[model samples]
Target chain A: MDRLLNIDRRIIFIFVLLGVAIPLLIDIHLPIKPTPTVRAVYDEIERVSIEDPDRPVLVSFSYGASTMPEMEPMTRSILHHLFSRGRKVVGICLWPEAVGLAQPIMDELAAEFGMKYGTDYAFLGYKPGAQAVVLNLGQSMAGTFPFDTAGTPVGDLPILAKVQNLKDFSFVFDFAAGDSMEFWWIPYGQEKHRFPFAGGCTAVMAPDLYPFLQSRQLVGLLGGLAGAAEYEALIGVSGSATSGMEPQSVTHVIIILFILLGNTVYFTTRRRGGKA
Target chain B: MTRDSYVFVGFLALFALVNTILVANGALSLDWDGLGVIVAAGCTLALYSFLYKDNPLFKFAEHVYVGVAAAYVFGITWYNSLYGEIIVSYFDIGEKGANGGGHNPWVLLFPTLLGLLMLTRFSRKFSWLSRISFAFVVGVGAGLTIPRYLSSFLLGQLEPSLAPLTLSWAGLNLFLVLVGVITVLIYFFFSVEHTGVVGHASRLGIWFLMVSFGASFGYTIMARLSLLIGRISFLMDDWLHLM
Candidate 1:
């Protein structure tokens, strides 16, 4: 009972490592239920695909390489879904590290769909001031990101020819690891530009965003890899998140069981009138 | 040289030699970016080594990551933002403009001056000039934030919280949300005495807050575990070809 009180953290780490690694080595597919929150994101994109396929979907890559594990799958899957559906994509990164991680993904996915770079998809690249860029975007895209990641001027790119501001686009999806959504996009971009806003954040940030979701300010939320997995399901494409879901589910169940066992052991020892 | 230092240098030399040989042989397969796989595997293993204890390898990997990030950012700032946006646009060297007409060099002069003023912070005497630029930033930020904050956080949230609660399941959920909001607000209200029902509500508020905290903690665990899983997958799939 006392050992359960303060088990060595390394032991837990080893367990977690095995918990994650075993599922990767062996193939396992887990059932997933796409909640209404994830459905909203899919439905919004589907709506655009049906109504106006050429409308450039604005994707703010607000995450960095450090969060690539959670964010990369979401980024790749969403791009796959959008490009496969014949929706034009425009991307920007607030986090500088996102450049190295996201650009290659956009390239691979676009190539898979036989999408042209300057015409079908564009990477606006990294910007310095986040909120300032968001505010400036509400006014003008060319003014905010004058040059795409390739250093070709916006005027030279055909994808951004009709994209002058936020309103010209169809949907807003912010793949964020930080407060880019709360402080910048939610306040300035969505409020002023009036685009349907959706977000994919690290799981930790998801619980804090309930207020925004409840207020209907955010049309949908992708909470984490779980969210990414759900999005993959909605698109009917099994990507990295889907492959990784079983391990994640197993790891979570292990942690929950540990908690319950620990609690139970402590109480049972106390009931026996012994030190725990 | 010390024996330990000799061992360390020999280890590194051997590792580099093997990596190059493997890459040359295309053992990792050129399609996987063989050189990249070796380097990534080395860095990933080096980083994971710190879980056992701090070592020179982990420090080397950490520094390499930071250096690469810094160099990447500097290149982007020069090419994408500053040079492409400013120098080319101001001098009519680049084609992008908000309205398609070329930008006036005169229009950029004041902004260019203010930007230069911000650089004066490094000098002893001229640092006072940087205050003006800082003040301008702070003043504009304050002005813009007031209305946005009022409209988004205050008015927007308040309106939704005040929605009428009915008897349906949806309504019951809304009712629970409203009660949680009110009780939480009451818990923070220090103006009134909290001896009886107010204390009870405050305790309930604490329970609700605890539940929220617990949910956040659970999510945090999931987030961290996912990062671990991601790295392991990279190692197994991309580097070692174990998957």
Candidate 2:
């Protein structure tokens, strides 16, 4: 009985491996309902009519490859919705490693939408000085980013011709991983420039933002993969996040079972040990 | 070599063989980039192997990831932020050199000079000069951030906390949050001795903290497991031809 509690951690990992793998192979479609948090973001973007290039969406890809599994799907779905709505997008990355990561998605989606590079979408790649960068961008977009990622002067882009600063945009959506959203963007971009703010973050960071959400400082919040899946459902477009739901659900159940069983056995044996 | 060492080498050979087969089966054409899929799959397996036990393969993969990340960031920072924003604006080289005249913005020199001063931190004797740049950055940051934080985090949050509690769903939730906030604040008040109702409220504060912590723990677990599911899906759908 005690030996059962002492098996190698690898044995437990094998259980999780099977738990995640089997459901993924089965390809089950779990029903998902979008909460008001997800709905708020969708409705806000939906209000932007087609060919509304003047009020672009500022998407700060403040995350990297480590968060790609979760954030990438959100990025894709959001970018698709925005571009398809004929709304222009200006993407900037605070994380340097994310600059390369954003390239493929931006290229493929731009091609998919038949969107021109400068006029429809502008990817002003990563910069340092997180708070300072956000502050400068709030003041002047071209001042902070003279050239887009491809070295084309940003002012020359027909899409960004009138877009001077963060205030030109209708909304600011930061797909944040770290303190960039709450600390930098909220202060420098939203409060100073006074634009509506929406953000998606890792599940761990979601609870931390409840205070902000409750205050209505954050208009929308996408929590995690669950959030990504919810966003995918809201759009009626089943993407990678939708495909990942069954595996995620099953794995969570498996982990809960392990925790309960492990606790039951431990307490049972400990009482027996105390008596003996 | 020892028998165990030979077995390790044999396992590596078999792993490489399997990945090669998987890549070839998945490849669309004979393009050199086809090798990329094989490398990616191999690295994924190598990193996942750490779940079983740490080994040389995991170490190699970890080292490669770190090196590549550093080099990639170095290139990105140089071209994207440093050269593009500061250098390009200062020189006006592209427009001025070609067109014989361009708008030369002198405002960019402040940042250019500050950046140069920051570089002086590398020199032992002139390390103090960097403090000017450091002080400027910090002063500007604190000056900008304090008012914003107070308004957004403090006053904004206080609005919900201080709202009247009534007999409704949202009101009940608000009442509970208000109680939690007051108790949590009371718990942190070390200046007051916890002897009476204060002690009881502080005890309730512990429960609130525990509930908050439990929810965060569950969410963290979900985040980690989702990462695992993500990799597994990639292995199944993208790497192998199984899905």
Per lDDT, the best of the predicted structures is 1
Candidate 2 per-residue lDDT over residues B41-80, each given as its tens digit: 7889889867757788889999999999889888988888
The CA lDDT of each predicted structure is: 0.85, 0.81
Candidate 2 has a TM-score of 0.93
What's each prediction's TM-score?
A: 0.91, 0.93
* Candidate 1: tens digits of C-alpha lDDT, residues A1-276: 778787887887788888999999988777989988888888888888898777799999988777889999999878999999988899998988888788999999999999999999999898788888899899978778877876677777888888889998989899999988888998888877778889899998999888988888899899999999999898888888888898898899889988898889999989999798
The digit string of per-residue lDDT tens for model 2 on A120-155 reads 888988889888889888887876777778777776
Misplaced by over 4 Å in model 1 are A1-7, A268-276, B1-27, B30-32, B94-103
DockQ of 2: 0.58
Worst 10 residues of 2 chain B by lDDT: B96-105
Model 1 chain B lowest lDDT segment of ten: B94-103
Best by TM-score: 2
TM-score of 1: 0.91
